[model samples]
Target: MTDYVAKALEVDIDDAVRRVREISEQEAMNQAISVVGAGPAPGGAEWEAEQGTDTPAARQTAWQLVRLRIELATGIDPFGTVLGLRRMGTTWATIAAAAGVSRQAAHDRWGKQVLGVLDAYGTGELGGPVADDEADLRRGMAR
Candidate 1:
């Protein structure tokens, strides 16, 4: 929502949403500055995405810190789908053909995880626990 607005308007995300929604002009400006640091990323490259709001200082958000965290926290499990396909007797070559990747590349990306997941869950279902990467992210965010 906010992301789409930010990209569409070519303005800071806070300005695209929070700034326009504020009751007072000063509050909006302050909030915008606090996150965006007067100027940087389309929406405050310094913003502490983990915090979401009310960050004490700006930090480099390059390397896609916010997008990476958000994606890890919330999204479909392509790996899980791949695992299911493999369990269903789908060949790496077939999966790779659909995914537009080489067989070895697909295997290299998901083979280890798929092999461990069936045993780890002891289930052949489509979905179960979050992936290891998401689990690690949740653990980090817990602190």
Candidate 2:
């Protein structure tokens, strides 16, 4: 990808990470508070006696949330990759091929957004990860 596309990706990824962390922290706090407020189950003194506490359940829920956060963070990358392909002069057809969609579908989905970034790139406005040239971007993509 060109510097513009790389920079845009970096910003987007950073924002995604930040949003995930913030939401996860808030969710964790809510879960913790709810767990603390939860008393022994109704008419289950025997079960409570055996289980002791519900900390394990709360911890398990927290672990699930953590995994969800990771998945959301990683899932954002393909958007960047698609934008980068456009910046590198890849045809809409090729992008659509990689995306398992039709050329018109690709354009209908991402053309305007990609065009905006490309315009910014040409104007040297959306400064970002610097690449020497298209060849550098190709190599980076290969890896």
Q: TM-score for each prediction?
A: 0.32, 0.34
Per-residue lDDT for 91-118 in model 1, tens only? 6665566456776676677766876776
* Clash totals, every prediction: 0, 1
| Candidate 1 lDDT score relative to the true structure | 0.48
Off by over 4 Å in 1: 1-76, 119-143
- C-alpha local distance difference test of each model: 0.48, 0.53
Q: Clashes in model 1: which pairs? A: none
**Candidate 2 lDDT by residue in tens digits, 37-130:** 5444656865466475766454443443333333234453344445655554456665666556776676667765765776665674434432
Q: Which TM-score value belongs to model 1?
A: 0.32
User: RMSD for each model, in Å, please?
Assistant: 20.0, 18.9
